[model samples]
Target: MTFKELIEQRAQEKNLLFVPMAHRFQEGKQVYRLGHVMLYLDRNVIFVFNGKTWVPTSLQSLLDMAG
Candidate 1:
């Protein structure tokens, strides 16, 4: 499945929430190469590192973005 698909599936299965990250680089100034997709599943919400700091993005929002 595509990254979006995986995210959606996870959201459905676990009612996960996504938070986009704000920092694109690590402390070493090394750029992340995760291809605009990263997820941190917390008890209340999932954190998504979309090339930046963590920001909340809902499953519906993800679908909209994909489209």
Candidate 2:
């Protein structure tokens, strides 16, 4: 199975929330690499991928930035 599909299934099974990086940033899928499955635990607690590692960010801050 593809990475995206795999992640979707796993998220459903684990009851975890997931949103693709493409969708989260309001970008097109073609902008991101294929099979890029970046799933976070919840909307309140988001995990951001820096060049080195995943870092946590609050939903409120994310909302602020989006506006």
Candidate 3:
């Protein structure tokens, strides 16, 4: 699925507002925000914003932690 689709599905499931960044995942910019969590994906690696910096994490880890 596309990034928008993924965001929509997760937002519906969690009953939260998720906003995708105005641009696609390129270089190292953030891609989306689920509630207050900002995330970036590049080269199959996911990085989550931890208030101070982007930390590498897995998709499963992110979902579990997010929930």
Candidate 4:
């Protein structure tokens, strides 16, 4: 799916909240999460909550893994 579609899908998920952050990074812009995954839109990464820190997942990597 496209970026916009991804964003829309995430928004539709009742358990997930799509929050935009002011912070900027080389990979992507900052985003906050109230769920297990923190999504960064700019870099296109998903930070899985590991009880402490967020883990990064590349969009391309996820797509490849999905296929």
Kindly provide the TM-score of model 3 when superposed on the true structure, using C-alpha atoms.
0.58
Taking all chains together, each candidate's TM-score versus the true structure is: 0.36, 0.33, 0.58, 0.38
lDDT of 3 by residue, 1-67 (tens): 8754665686678776666778756365657876666787666676887888779886556666666
Q: Write the per-residue lDDT of candidate 2 for residues 1-67, one digit (tens) a residue.
A: 7544564465556555545445443122221221233424333345545457656665444333333
Task: For candidate 3, give the lDDT.
Answer: 0.69
Candidate 4 to native Cα RMSD, angstroms: 6.2
Two-way TM-score contest, 3 vs 4, winner = 3
Which lDDT values do the candidates have, in the order given? 0.48, 0.42, 0.69, 0.49
Residue-pair clashes per candidate, as listed?
Answer: 13, 0, 0, 3
The digit string of per-residue lDDT tens for model 4 on 1-67 reads 9774675464555434445545734244555543334445544445543457656766444333323
Off by over 4 Å in 4: 13-15, 22-28, 34-37, 41-43, 57-67
Which predicted model would earn the best lDDT? Answer: 3
TM-score, predicted candidate 1 vs. hidden true structure? 0.36
Best TM-score goes to which candidate? 3
Inter-residue clash pairs, candidate 2: none
**Candidates by lDDT, descending order:** 3, 4, 1, 2
